[model samples]
Target chain A: AQSVSQHNHHVILSEAASLELGCNYSYGGTVNLFWYVQYPGQHLQLLLKYFSGDPLVKGIKGFEAEFIKSKFSFNLRKPSVQWSDTAEYFCAVNRRTGFQKLVFGTGTRLLVSP
Target chain B: GAGVSQSPRYKVAKRGQDVALRCDPISGHVSLFWYQQALGQGPEFLTYFQNEAQLDKSGLPSDRFFAERPEGSVSTLKIQRTQQEDSAVYLCASSLDGGVSQPQHFGDGTRLSIL
Candidate 1:
């Protein structure tokens, strides 16, 4: 079975601090990676996705993620974070050839303090 | 609709009661999905539909959970004799197709609470 692991459960950072949320998956095949963000009382929104080609992908709201194939990791990062950036982040993976059933990781809750 | 829409944003039901959750996908979307998100956890796939056909339902926890996209555009997830463990936020997502590259559009989920 495929599973995603998010190393952080909770993170606290001051405004302007850099953010890095680690995500690792246990799949050996070609996979599609995604990062989703859920704001307080809001629906989950896609932050970015990686299919093929360049390993680095930029997403909305100045967010970006690097799909390191060797490490089996797709970590999300932002140079600076604001209080508005506080939200729950989820990492999801699915095989590139199947019905695209997403397997999501336990989410990381980030609190950006002003 | 501009985006995927789910009804009864909040639902509170007593144990052993049956509850039905509705999802309306974007117009012309060929794929629809249902997911369950427990408190403080990521969403988990429950079922998938392509048009009016349910292509995959392997993620459904048990026989108590049933879903139907009779016409393909509107879907319903029915939980029979709901238990406490059934409490979670049920989310609906849709994509242009079941293709791997298509990004899914999500709706504000229906938060189900079993009392």
Candidate 2:
């Protein structure tokens, strides 16, 4: 079955720490990738998405993700994380055709301590 | 409303009871989706609707689960004879179209607890 995987279940970091949350998908066809963030008591929000273009895409709040097709990976990254960045992050993908339903990975919980 | 909206932010029901969860997508959104999110896990797709048509129900786990988008604007998910394993947060999302690239807007979700 097709699935998305996030190797890190939980991560802790101090303020200003660089961050990288790994995401890998098991699909062989063309796909669109996305990163979503959910703060405490909030709904999921789109951080960024990669359809087709430059492999690296930047999103709001200084977040970015690189889509490495050869590796079937689209890892999220941030140069410096703030305490306010603590939240759950999910990586998702969908086929480039047919129903556009997303298949999401088990999310990574990030705690950025001050 | 400006975003996708789901009703009954929380619901508690005994096992075997029937429950209905409602969702109101953005006025102009052409695509709607339903997902079930278990604790400590990401949301899993349950169903999809394009306007008034039910394009896909493949993600539904059992025959007891039913979803409808009768008029194309509002949608509902009905679970008959719910089981303890049915307890999860039900999320609703909508996008401008069924396009491969449209970003979906999600609601806060309705947390369902089956006792």
lDDT of 1 by residue, B1-115 (tens): 3999999999999999999999999999999999999998889999999999999999899999999999879999999999999999999999998899999989999999999
What CAPRI-style quality would you assign to candidate 2? high
Docking class of 1: high
DockQ of candidate 1, scored on C-alphas against the true complex (2 decimals) = 0.85
lDDT of 1 by residue, A1-114 (tens): 899999999999999999999999998789999999999988999999999999999999999999998999999999999999999999999999978789999999999999
TM-scores for all candidates: the values are: 0.98, 0.98
How do the residues B75-115 of candidate 2 rate in per-residue lDDT, one tens digit apiece? 99999999999999999999999888899999999999999
Which whole-number lDDT from 0 to 100 does residue A79 have in model 1? Answer: 100
Q: What TM-score is obtained for chain B in each of the predicted models?
A: 0.98, 0.98
Per-residue lDDT of candidate 2, residues A69-94 (tens digit):
99999999999999999999999999
Best by DockQ: 2
- Each model's DockQ score: 0.85, 0.88
Model 2, stretches more than 4 Å misplaced? none
Q: lDDT score, residue B26, model 2?
A: 89
Assess the local accuracy of residue A68 in candidate 2 as a C-alpha lDDT between 0 and 100.
Answer: 95
